[model samples]
Target: MIIDLARFVEKERPYWQELEKALDEIRARLLDLSDLKQSRRVLGLFQRACSDLARVGQANAEPELRNYLETLVARGYSEIHSSQTYVRRFRPLHWFLRTLPRTFRRQMWAFNLSVALTLIGMLVGGILLVADPDGRQVALAPFPHVAHQTPSQRVADEETANNDKQKMLEERKSSFSAQLMANNIGVSIKAMAFGLTWGIGTALLLFYNGVILGAVCLDYMLDGQTVFLLGWLLPHGSFEIPAILIGGQAGFVLARALIGWGTRDGMRTRLRMIVPDLATLIGGVALMLVWAGIIEAFFSQYHAPVLPYWLKITFGSIELVILVAFYWYCGRKTGPEEEAEQ
Candidate 1:
């Protein structure tokens, strides 16, 4: 029946129109099939019929054709009742994966903008880190008192020196691993949340973050801590930055949706249809956070000098590969039709 509907919609406008009318009749009949035992079967048929009608409507641009298609949809929706079974046996995760690219395609502009901002943040941060001796202080200006001291001044005060040394050693211990993970997760969330202010908040957050990173790198370089810095930052930064980027991407999506709602008359309806995409983006961000937390807490803080630099590089490369793979899978071109099939 689905195949026939597909063929009709593709090849014959008249049959497509007839199929929509037939679906309306089926939908009305299903509504009257209110017996609880038969609800699932009837609801399934109703949903399939409605979906077929929508496909037919979308494949054609004729006003009359669209009007007829919409009438069938309205008729089907009118008959839906609270007693009808809405649940299906299909796995949500499977459907989410199948539809992800289609969702991403619809928000491609937002996605691209977020990515550009993230890269700018990283680049600015890296350059500042390499060039400025007091970059950390500038980056961390929002914090009180911590950035005031020069590296020499900071290292000279016995009390502060001892405290910092102790803190560093404690961080090296496995027990302090959770703190690192928590810190990274908090940073990512903040970056994402800041994006809601029309990307202004995001820009500021990224700039400040970049400054702090730059300052830290500068301090390390000045102190001849290159090897130690590389060992500490590389493992986790690989996953951490990309995760933050993904969060920024999500923020961009929300901003775009809001803009669309304001500018287009029927945008809310379209947004409702794409709610699943927003859910998927949120899910992806959550997954990235979990991965970042795990890496920071366990692998990055390990003090074992015996762990080869090559191994660290390899792991970092693997993380990048995973990030790329996820984007590719979720942005593939054939996603929409495949999702409808599923």
Candidate 2:
């Protein structure tokens, strides 16, 4: 049977056009080809284009039609074969702005639960301190100097005069910042690693952190320095807290995989599946903690009292807003590939 080359070209032109459009969108960064649906479509289109190129050759189609099919197939092939990861294009910035938020949003349930657990610990610690002042020592165990003395007593002591305090703070600023950064990183790494224990360690860490914070707040409140403490903690804690919570969420992801006992997928397979999201969470937490360390060491202590209390609080609030906006709105826009995937 003689093949109707002219009729075939006419019929398949739409498919060729679709393939070209898909390629254009993907190359232009309008589409996210990572979504399974969109990725499948792209592959299918590329295959069809390849088949059409072969058909044109077999039919001995006119030069114009053959060249058109050849070009379409070439473009589709290049795009489909090239690296498709979001990181392949924009690198770190892309991961931070788009991938981090997307991963966080996907694991919001774990995050919310972590937050709830932390809040409970804070409340319990605060209530215990109020109910029995002796419990303050337990709550403030993490802070040696502040644990034994009231904030007022510490402020008024001869050895800890304002000038001496300022001098000591200024001298230790760099070391303190480094220490804080190291501690934050340690906490995050532990929170992620402890998922091997089925999340018990992570949960305990979150609670302990909250209790520490609550006890510190109680210390300041009893000394009538609530505003002062807020100024000190809010600036860095705004970022630090979220980073820690994200770590907790990451741990939960691993814990979930480990507990996949009844599921069709084995624990190891589940672990591999969540590797991308876990990496993103851990990386984002590290970046946030770095920023927190800077603010805590250099800015928070200096500005907490120098700036008006209201202004400091406002700045912290603004930072919190920025964090929320970054996670909620960043990378929400769908490119052509993403839209097709949906």
**What do the candidate models score in CA lDDT, each in turn?**
0.58, 0.83
Question: Residue 250: error of model 1 in Å?
Answer: 0.9
lDDT of 2 by residue, 3-41 (tens): 697788778888888888888998887877788999898
What TM-score would every model get versus the actual structure? Answer: 0.57, 0.70
- Which 10 successive residues of model 2 have the least lDDT summed? 152-161
Candidate 1 Cα errors over 4 Å, as ranges = 1-108, 122-136, 140-195, 214-230, 261-267, 270-274, 304-306, 329-342
User: Per-residue lDDT for 257 in model 2?
Assistant: 82
Q: Which candidate is the best by TM-score?
A: 2
Give the runs in model 2 whose Cα sits over 4 Å from its true position: 1-90, 154-161, 261-263, 303-305, 340-342
Model 1 error, position 198 (Å): 2.7
